[model samples]
Target: MTSFSAAQRSRVTMLDVAERAGVSKASVSRFIGDDRALLSDAIALRIEQAIDALGYRPNQMARGLKRGRTRLIGMLVADIRNPYSIAVMHGVETACRQHGYNLVVCNTDRDDEQERQHLAALRAYNIEGLIVNTLGHHLEQLLELQREMPLVLVDRKVDALHSDLVGLDNPLAVRMALEHLEQQGYRDILLVSEVADGTSSRVERLHSFQSQVSLRKDLRGAIQETGPDLHTRLQAFLAQDGAGPKALFCANGIAALACTKALRELGCRLFEDIGLIALDDLDWYPLVGSGITALAQPTQAIGTSAFDCLLKRLRGDTSPTRSLDFAPQLLIRGSTQPL
Candidate 1:
């Protein structure tokens, strides 16, 4: 018979699981921690069964203190105003809580100085892992942190940092958007994006658009960045006489919003005078005029995967660095219709 009451069993701990499994605390820890690969199958099964039976949960806060891990994960966001960032952050927070970790998110607002300051603040808190979504301008600080903990990059790629990456499959997404445009009988395509700002995602999308246009001899593609002059540039595109139907392909949600506003200002009919499809669908996509067709990135999945990559490293799984690229789901809406 167990010495403790049923009440004690209800408040099960790692010690309870270890005792019930007839194993040492170290062995039980190895089973739950990142070093489970070191344990034999039989031992692993025993520990799992014991945990299940006792309903034991690891007190990560207490355990982290003992192991010098704070069970805190840090995320650096470039533009919190961007819908994509907000959606991804929600996913990260959900996954962190599920895995007994807490998230400390810092929004740099796409500023380099703020990025540096946030990185320093995250380090001060001794975060066990980091998931970054900003342009990694401060290389020295990033490199220093990577030495002590795991880092996973999302959406943007930092040069010379060989860490796990969790992001959308940009090439595939670009291809999908182009193909949809072509199918809808759009020949002249204007790919509008925000300024590259050294962001890998934007750069890749731009490059992909150029490449796609090159391969499709019948199609002509032009590039424009959203800025104060977006209205002027878009007006010129609308006036230009092209071979066939002209459509605006927004590289992401921000670009879509900007281009849509420009079209509104020009008093151009949506999808009647110009067709449009954008990347990274926001909730307001359907509410827009005739709805905006989109190649929607699995933002939540990308965020959750980034945290999972960091968690694996924190748990001591020192295997090859992983790159998780999720595919987009094409949501065909009225915006991509032919004239």
Candidate 2:
């Protein structure tokens, strides 16, 4: 008999198991697959004994592929560092585990080239479905993927994709935020957001804010993008005397953090110089001079629902496309207090 190292033992294959059992490879396959019941007790016992003796484990990916199911779900996130993405991904992962599927997440860092690369890699893996929280810059690739598998869009919608969508009701959420600010005596408002870049959610929020501000005679509102000029812009906005006490409506968590930093840089007293209300309640919201008021999206529920939509499609669901819009809960803090 020949001796084998641990590495050699780990490389043991099905053929090795069959040779050890003194049986054919087909017999071994039958013993391990759906045809197990077809194997006689004597042959099945030999195969089992050989497998245990050799510490053999079947390749689950290969087995799954043979059954036309890899049991893997893919998720593409625009920015993984965003707290909102992290929270939502947690929910998606939990749902996947419950349903005996695995999640493969790819972060594009908001780059079109990276987005295309990730999409290509995910397609090569034959993922069962896709959850997109990206800018959808690579529309051609996305459309192709949609043809191959069901896609669920999160937080943002791609034009002409016509797939399922899971996100906050942007119009209603913006309305709620504005209503809260107005109730707190914040009449002069600035909507701070990341550059729209054709992202559907941002556009929706911006349009809603504009429409609502126009409807109210007492309220004054303007929009700003978070960038290098943000600090200078903040200074100008703060210096203006009219429009009553002012407040900042941050469009999302990333924008909230950026605007807060700009405010700090401009030496403004938090909530005293300018009030702040932001979408997406981050963990550090309460630690600021005055806690930041926020419209918190149901991230976990949204993620779970996205997966549920994908599951339905995988199970032969041919229903019309769906749009699942969730609501946000307002959490009042010192940031939106009347000054």
Top lDDT prediction, candidate number: 2
**Best model per TM-score:** 2
**Which digits, one per residue and each the tens of the lDDT, describe model 1 over residues 1-339?**
235556765598778888888888899999888899998898889899988777676766676777897879999999898899999999999999999889999999988899999999999888889999988989899999999999999988997888998898888998898888998899999999999988998899899889988999878999999999999999999898996899999998899999988899899998899999999888889988889998998988988888888888987999998788999999999998865
Candidate 1: give the clashing pairs.
Answer: 34-315
Least accurate stretch of 10 residues (summed lDDT) in model 1? 1-10
TM-score of each: 0.81, 0.91
Task: Please list the residue runs of candidate 2 whose C-alpha ends up more than 4 Å from where it truly belongs after superposition.
Answer: 1-10, 19-49
lDDT per model, in order? 0.89, 0.91
Clashes of 1: 1
Candidate 1 local lDDT, residue 69: 76
- The C-alpha local distance difference test score for the whole of candidate 1 amounts to 0.89
Supply candidate 1's per-residue lDDT for 34: 82
- lDDT per residue, candidate 2, 221-331, as tens digits? 999999989999989999987579899999998999998888888888989988899999999998988799989999999999999999999999999998999999999
How far does residue 222 in candidate 2 sit from its true spot (Å)? 0.6
